[model samples]
Target: MKGIVMEVYEDKVIVLAKDGSFLEVNRDNRDLDIGQEIEVDDNNKKIRGRIIKRLASIAAAFILLITTGYGVYGYYTPYGYINVDINPSVEIAYNLYNRVIDLKGLNEDGNILISKIKNYRNRTIENVINEVIDTAVEQAYVRPEQENVILITITEKKDKVDDEKIYKLVDSHIKQKIENTEVILIEGDNNIYKRAREDKISPGKLMLIEKAIDLNKDIKFEEVAKKPVKEIMRMIKEAKREKEKKEERKKLEKKTEKEMDKIEEMKFNKSRKAKGKKEDKLEREEIEKFRKDKTKKDEEEKEIEVDKIEKYKEKDQRRYLKKKSQDEFEEQRKEKQENLIINDNKKNQDNKYKVDKSEKKNKSKRGHENEYKHNKKERGKDED
Candidate 1:
């Protein structure tokens, strides 16, 4: 039965099943959390099961231990060199406390391998090496169930570590963690290391290349060395597929960028056309306004000219009327003078006639008087 651990106690664990039933399993607390998954061991009547964690951790600690107490006798427990050659080479040295004391890279490929397993230092060398192999297998550095050659050499004193102890610790661990790989152990003279230095390749890589050459006599080490480990492992087929995929992805991205640029250009052209239209409209309105103002000014000027002409006509008419009145007045005055002159002449004639009549009367009287005086003179002379 599989269940989630609800609680952990000193001697038991309470697990919650999927059916909402609580089960108390009588087992030692293995640092299990409340939500840890566990399987019930069917063989044991005591409801005991393994607590499964992540796949990586499970692969790292695949070995089942016989003894329970995790103990080290001293602080300076030294486990000598463990040289691993998978085409990459690595040599790891551990102290009694399971911490890494020194590491050596046999070649360029081995350099980064040390960094991969460096964190496992100061821990148990068994589980640490298990983690290294498991991680390497997952990363495709080592192909399990394939023809990869591995050579392991451990050198230590009898008191510190023995052959059987080292063999039991590493041999089964590698076998259980990795599969189908030829493992070679060297106690005295390591010609593999000498061969690696001469070839300028790691011992692990040299082993693999020689193994491949053994299968095909026509293949040369120089030709195989030109290819990387992953390419060599895939035999050149997968590498071609990966390259093609990368090229396809790049082409798709370039096409997408081109489409986006075209869209932006179209938008910019649209905006430019809009702005041009707006400017043209404003220019047209300005032209209309200017024409209207010009027409208005012309009309006003025409009105002003018409008013001036009307005023001039009125002034001319007034002047003409004044001149005619003056001429009429002068003609009346001349007529009046002529009439007065005629009247004066007639009065003078009458006066002359009256004076003449008076004179005539006087003369007639004088004549009569003269006649009477002649008669009186005749009478007086007769009387004398």
Candidate 2:
């Protein structure tokens, strides 16, 4: 079977022959899609499948060593001669496309539209040529999962994806593929002058981080949106900075509110003390007036007792009543006068104390208000 292959696990082995209708023989893996014959020891101890090995076999010589048709006949195939070098199957496909489409003629307007279409078809599969180059490279470094190199040629003039957008798209999608295989890219044009140099990329182990692009295919942004490592790390740093800033702002606001509350409490305390002092003053004043009225009434009673002494004509009665009046009036008046003086002094002391405390309280309250203002300014500065 020319194209028969059996895949075990992830490796594909070419099935080349059948022995005794039950056992099988196969060409050793070479990673190329083309088929060739190989010779092995009678007991399968020795296997030969390399390029030189194929030269010893007649069947391999027919496929790779000899050319008997109007196909590539030289190692130095020229710029316009790649299609001639391709395998017969691809050659037949190209001929069919040419016959069915007449891709080389011109119209009445002398426009070379057919020529352009032929060019398009040719460039569409240019990577088949690059595959040859990749195989040459892979000879030394046969990548795991078989990394592939494709050569693509673009037409001279036609519609294509935007170049910059294509770069961004491709760089994001091709990062995930078979292990150890990093696909290589190269592009050229009709004169076959290369436009873009080759890019060899390694696959990502975590998530697919390479950009993969498909020409003339529709794909979405998220499907290929892996940010470069540098970009992602930069974003993380920026997020941390923003979070720190927010936390600092909240602290500033909290400190400012705390200071404001302290100032408010000081103001309240100062006003409450001032109000209490006023009430105390009023109460003292009422006490003074009541004491004075009671003292005046007691003096009138003392004068009446003096008249009783004079009206008692007898010496004994006069002496006894005089003694009573003197003792009672003197003692009572002395006590009342002492009480009045003490109460007046107490009122004066209370007023003085209140005045001193009020001054200190007002000063303290003003200091608290100023402190709050300073704190507010500091908080604002911090936020800025």
Candidate 3:
């Protein structure tokens, strides 16, 4: 059946068929737009339809709807298209709600992405596209380490999603995949051509180079792309110099800190040595004082012992002098007594001689005999 689109809404659409019957249909196809013809197919009164883009003749639509006896108009949300061509070429049509309404894999290489794309139906386009690219990377269709070129075509939508938003969405999705893959992005649009004209650079090279610059800010898009390798090397050398300077500064700081620590350690050692020396000096002083005290005490003891010995000698000398005096006096007295006895005997003999000498020779003889006898008696008394 065929119908002319009459009314459109967010979720459904109304179509006026040739039988003058108004039909409502669920909108599931993304390609359907306003002011378009459609063909409805009925299987057991269940209706499904697709928009016919090339069919613009209203009379032909009426004749087809009359013959089929039933017709419906299908509504689909207006959205943009994202065409990704790696080794695999896939077209994804999404709605304003970011839903994947249509998907097509144009080549045999697309099987990797196609198999995974179904899992993201009616999901956000960014999420679904990210999953698809990830799947492609996993399957090695898009090599991760090598230079993989991606061509993105975005159909601009008004009052819904802008060109910038779509471009960023596509770029983010592709970047989220193939972490080690170096990507070269080629944008197909008048915007890329305009930038190319303004920079006086080729559009193809400009877009890819700009993308490279966006990915790595180190590459000055305007400066290094057209310059020789020598200039690029110079730029890299300058960056290396900056990095070296930072490292040198850090090394210098560490060296300074180390030097300070060494100085502090030396000072501590010096202080400890000084303190040890002071302690040693005090110990030496204490030892010297003790020695002095001991020596003084010994000298005092020696002096005391000498004084005691001198007193004992003086007492012994006095005792010996007294004994000698007594012995000398007694000897003197005995000598005198013996002298006196001798003198007395001499006196007595003188007195007796004077009496006897005169009176007789005869009497003298007798007296001589008597004198001898008296001498004998005196000898006996002396002996006794």
Q: Write the per-residue lDDT of candidate 3 for residues 1-384, one digit (tens) a residue.
A: 775555567776655555645566556753334433555544213223443332324435644543453332111443555666555666677765555667776556665568764334444566556666777777777665665555554543544445566557656766776554333334455676456447654344455565455544677776655642223334555666776898999999999999999999999889778878778799799999999999999999999999999999889889988888988899999989988998899889887776666546668788899999999999999999
Q: Report the Cα lDDT for candidate 2.
A: 0.39
Instruction: Return the candidate ranking by lDDT, descending.
Output: 1, 3, 2
| Candidate 3 clashing pairs, residues 3+ apart or interchain | none
Error of 1 at 174 (Å): 3.5
Cα-based lDDT for every prediction: 0.62, 0.39, 0.61
Clashing pairs in 1: 77-95, 77-96, 87-204, 87-205, 98-122, 98-123, 99-122
For residue 80, model 3's alpha carbon misses the true position, in angstroms, by 2.1
Best by TM-score: 1
User: Model 1, 268-354: lDDT tens per residue?
Assistant: 888768888778788789999999999999999999999999999999989999999999999999999999999999999999999
lDDT of 2 by residue, 1-384 (tens): 222222212333333333411113443443323222233234432224463244335344433532444333421122221211101101101221111111221112112222212212222222233333233233432334543322112222323323344333333333332234233222334333221112111112011222222211242324333333233223444555766788999999999999999999999888767878787788789899899998988988988888777676467787989999999999999999999999999999999999999999999999999999999999999999
Compare the candidates by lDDT and give the number of the best one: 1
In candidate 3, how many Å is residue 201 off? 26
Clashes per candidate, residues 3 or more apart or on different chains? 7, 14, 0
Error of 2 at 138 (Å): 11
